[model samples]
Target: MNVSVELTFTPLQNEYEPPISAFIKRVRASGFTVLENPLSTQVYGDYDGVMHMLTKEIKNSLSNIDIGLFQMKIVKTDRSSYVADF
Candidate 1:
C-alpha cells in the first residue's frame, strides 16, 4: 500500500536549526518523494519504504539531541498530487 506522511520535527535545544535542517536534508536524500514548507515536511512512497526510511532517520535524528519532538501525521493514500483550489 502507498502512504503519505507529514513530519514536523522540533528540536528543543537552544540551537534548533541544525537538527531540523539535517533531518529534512536526510529525508530528502532518502530518494522518496518529498515536499517541504516553512513549517513542515511531507514524504510520499510505499508504506514499507516510507516507514522504514523514517524509522532510521528519526532514530538517528533524535538520538543526537537531548530533547526533541516529532509531530507526525499519516494517511493511507498519497496526497502529493493534491492541488489547492480556492
Candidate 2:
C-alpha cells in the first residue's frame, strides 16, 4: 500500500542548522516525493519503502547529533487525499 507522512526533525543543540539540513538532504536522496515546508517535510511513496528509508535515515541523523527528536504523522492513503496542496 502507498502512504503519506509529515516528518519533523528537531535537534537539541545550539547549532542545529547543519544537522537539520543534512537530514532533509537524506530524505530527498531516498527518492520519495518530498514537499519541504518550514516546520515539516511531507513524504509520499510506498509504505514499505517510506518506512525503511525513514528508519535508516532517522537513525543516521540521530547518530550524527546524538540527541534529537523525530516526529511523524502518517496515513495509509494516497498523496492527493492525505497531503494538502500536493
Candidate 3:
C-alpha cells in the first residue's frame, strides 16, 4: 500500500547543506522523491520503499556529515493526493 511519510531532520548548520543535498540524492535514487524541501522533506512512495531508503540509505549517506534525523512521522493514506484532504 502507498503511504505518506513526513521526515524532519534536525537543522544542520549551513555547512551541512551539502550533506542534506547528498541525502536527498540518495533518497531519490531509492525511488523516494522529495515532495518538499530537505529541511522538512515530505516524501511519497510505498511503505517498504520509504522504510528501506530512510533506514538504510539516509543514515549511511549522512554518517560522515555532522547531521542527525530528529523526527520521522509516517502516516498511511488511501489516496495519493495530500492537498485536498490534508
Candidate 4:
C-alpha cells in the first residue's frame, strides 16, 4: 500500500528551530516524496517505508527535546502530485 502523511513538529521550548530543521533535513533524505510549507510537511511513499522512516525519525526528534508535539495525518492515497483545479 502507498500513503501520504502530513506532519507537524512543534517543540514546546524557546529554541525550537534546531530540532524542526534537523527533522526536515532528515525527512528529506528519506527518499520519499516530501512537500513542505510553513504549517506542515507532507510525505508520500510506500506505507511501510514511510511509516518506518517516520517512526525512527519522530522518535529521534522527540528524544532530543524536553517536550514536543507531533501532529500527523495519514491518507489512504498519495497526494504528492496533487494540484488545485478549482
For model 1, residues 12-46, the per-residue Cα lDDT tens digits are 99999999989999999999999999999999999
Q: What TM-score, to 2 decimals, does candidate 3 have? A: 0.72
Instruction: Give the runs in model 3 whose Cα sits over 4 Å from its true position.
Output: 11-14, 78-80, 84-86
> Can you rank all candidates by TM-score, best first?
4, 1, 2, 3
For candidate 4, give the lDDT of residue 32: 95
TM-score list, all predictions: 0.97, 0.89, 0.72, 0.98
Judged by lDDT against the true structure, how good is candidate 4?
0.97
Poorly placed runs, candidate 1 (over 4 Å):
none
RMSD of each: 0.6, 2.5, 2.8, 0.4
Cα error, residue 75 of model 2, in Å, equals 0.8
Report every candidate's CA lDDT: 0.96, 0.89, 0.67, 0.97
Candidate with top lDDT is 4
lDDT of 2 by residue, 12-75 (tens): 9999999999999989888888888899988998999999999999998999996899899998
| Candidate 2 stretches greater than 4 Å from native | 80-86
lDDT at residue 13 of model 1 (Cα atoms): 93
Error of 1 at 34 (Å): 0.2
Q: Rank the candidates by lDDT, best first.
A: 4, 1, 2, 3
Q: Following a full C-alpha superposition, what root-mean-square deviation does model 2 have from the true structure?
A: 2.5
CA deviation > 4 Å runs, candidate 4: none
